[model samples]
Target: MTAVQGFVRQIDLPQIHDPRGDLTFVEGGKHIPFEIRRVYYLYNVPVDAERGGHAHRELEQVVFALSGSFRIKIDDGREKSEYWLRDPRKGLYINRLVWREMDSFSQGAVCMVLASHRYDEGDYYRNYDDFLAAIRVAAE
Candidate 1:
């Protein structure tokens, strides 16, 4: 557990190479700590465009770069870290109570996310200040 950033770390997915092509897969509860309840992808983003400027109250996720590359900045109210995602066979795990921002996308960057929960607006802290407050409440 990376306390400061709520970043569990990078997890390598199962990969299989074949003569025709290659394949990589992730299994919920088998490879990841949570069962996947949602799946989403981001694509066609401008290089300088930023995404994800909030924190989750009780959500977990794994981010993957299905194509191209990008950078994600994570902050858990105290510390910050930057990660690059360029491998399709790897995923970055993010725990709850963490703030994240995604930017610096390369050309044709395609970001895929596997989430532990379905959409719930109340579970999100859309503002940094709110997130900090929630973090403090959680600590107590």
Candidate 2:
């Protein structure tokens, strides 16, 4: 495990096997570290594209790629790290105030995000340069 400055957590779940296929489920208190208030998925996206280039002020999130694969870049106003999510049973838990970006999505990739709070525009930091500057200042 990598040492990240902020409160991002990664959890690998146990995958259940079946004769038909595989099954993986994350309940509110089981696989997820936080209570889930919102659930959404992103798919049919183009290649060489990026999404979620922002930081949340108070909302915590757990991102998982249920189908194919994708790469997530996370920064915590001090250090940064990148994670490649390819398995359905693995999740990346991002704490509040951490900037995240999702990119390099493979074909048929389905990215699912579980949030601790509902949608609020005020919780996001959408500017990349501002995020970098804030990190630089915090490190000093």
Candidate maximizing TM-score: 1
Compare the candidates by lDDT and give the number of the best one: 1
Q: Which digits, one per residue and each the tens of the lDDT, describe model 2 over residues 58-115?
A: 7888899988999999888768899999988889988777899899999888999999
Reference-based lDDT, residue 136, model 1? 84
Q: How much does candidate 1 score in TM-score? A: 0.93
- Candidate 1, residues 1-140: lDDT per residue as tens digits? 22333555898998899999998888898888889999999999999899999889889999999999999999988899999999999999999988999999999999999998999999999989999988787778
Supply the TM-score for candidate 2. Answer: 0.86
Model 2: weakest 10-residue lDDT segment is 1-10
Error of 1 at 86 (Å): 0.3
Clashes of each: 0, 0
Clashing pairs in 2: none
List candidate 2 stretches off by more than 4 Å.
Answer: 1-5, 129-140
Assess every candidate by TM-score. 0.93, 0.86
